[model samples]
Target: MEDFFKGRDTGLVIDWTQMPTYNTIMAVAAGAGLIFMYMLGRALVRDRDFRAEGWALTAGVLGFILTATGLHMTLEWPFATYFPFDNIVFGEPSLAFGVLLLAASLFLWKRGDKIVAAEDRAAEAAATARPLGIFVLGMGLALFGIALAGLVFQLFAAPAEEPISGIVADYPMIEAIFMSLLFAFVGLGAALFPIALRGFSSTRPLSGTAKLVGVVWLVTGIIFLLFGAMNFFTHIGLIVNTMQ
Candidate 1:
């Protein structure tokens, strides 16, 4: 029992090569990236048809997955054997994003038909904005705080027990900075959403700030997708190195 506990503490209990869970999680993250890209693009193109139901369903499912994974990480600290701070760095943001996405999904699912069928969709959406909009804006603020924490703490020093850290063991600081920027992009987009939502409600075009937010999401999405894809290779290498 002591040996088992020690192995768990040292991150030696699990065989890294046999566990491809990180790759799977990264793939889900890539899908999430694609969803954000599509959502932001649609928002940018105000005249485009709203596929609310489809997107709502997709986002809800993904949001649920992220929420579950994040909640587990926070409560159980699965992979953060050596550095518990890793749990906060990865878990908190995931939880925030997941909750917001789930809320958005629910809003769309409940009001999708009304939104789609209305002659003035913006007005319909505007009428529907109450607690949900406020909730999202608050979450946006939380994400921003998380981003700031990541930067200030230099969480890139995360130990090898964290999979991504293992993958970039040589350039931890660079990876940390890049990841911090990505979170900042997402946080900025979320924080600016209410302004854009208000613009939509008033039937005004997307403001410069709103358009910039869309662009930020686009860039972040692309980077996440690429990073997730690249991890399939790099993560495997990490595991193999661990085995040796």
Candidate 2:
């Protein structure tokens, strides 16, 4: 048995294909795995009003997916370095944030069984929450505007009339997808913040959907934005170290 096991270990146990289509399919499969888990959890968990959670408190679950993906990417760096250091650059923080999200989700669950909107008297919050939300809306738009301008200039004019050796090369599809996500995240998220603020600041309680939207935007936006900024610092360090 020892001899047989040793022989089996001699060759690679996981020989992945080098085909791009295969790799894309693998990525999609991994994402589908997470969604499957989310759907399963959604079907299983219930609320006080018998409402099963959709994306509520699913950050923790998403965190777990990220953590797994990050670790896998990091570990498989040699075999899976699609764009060079992509794994190390993205994986570590994803693992950390995943853990943080898990802790936060547990705390929410322990305190309130699930994520519940603070339906405090809107009259009480209106004086504070509404104005604050509007302020946040402006800030979000400002940040998004900067990102948009930077991307536009970088993709268009920076190359002196046409983009060269940049994101719009052979990876136009990837670039398009990224731009779409950016627009959706920043535009939709910024758009929702004020409305959510309105709901939160209303004289009456917030609707369930509104509460969900607000919470998703606020929590997800802050977390990912913070993580992204941290990634910039990490990349700078890498560059400095490489130069040294």
- Superposed model 1: Cα runs more than 4 Å off: 1-49, 126-130, 157-171, 201-203
Off by over 4 Å in 2: 1-59, 71-82, 88-100, 113-174, 177-244
Error of 2 at 123 (Å): 12
Residue lDDT tens for model 1, 102-198: 8768988987877877776765665565446676577667767766776777665434644655656566676668777877777777777667655
Q: How far is candidate 2 from the true structure (C-alpha RMSD, Å)?
A: 14.1
- State model 2's lDDT: 0.41
User: What is the lDDT of every predicted structure here?
Assistant: 0.63, 0.41
Least accurate 10 contiguous residues by lDDT in model 2:
156-165
| Superposed Cα RMSD, model 1 | 4.9
Can you give the lDDT of residue 32 in candidate 2?
A: 35
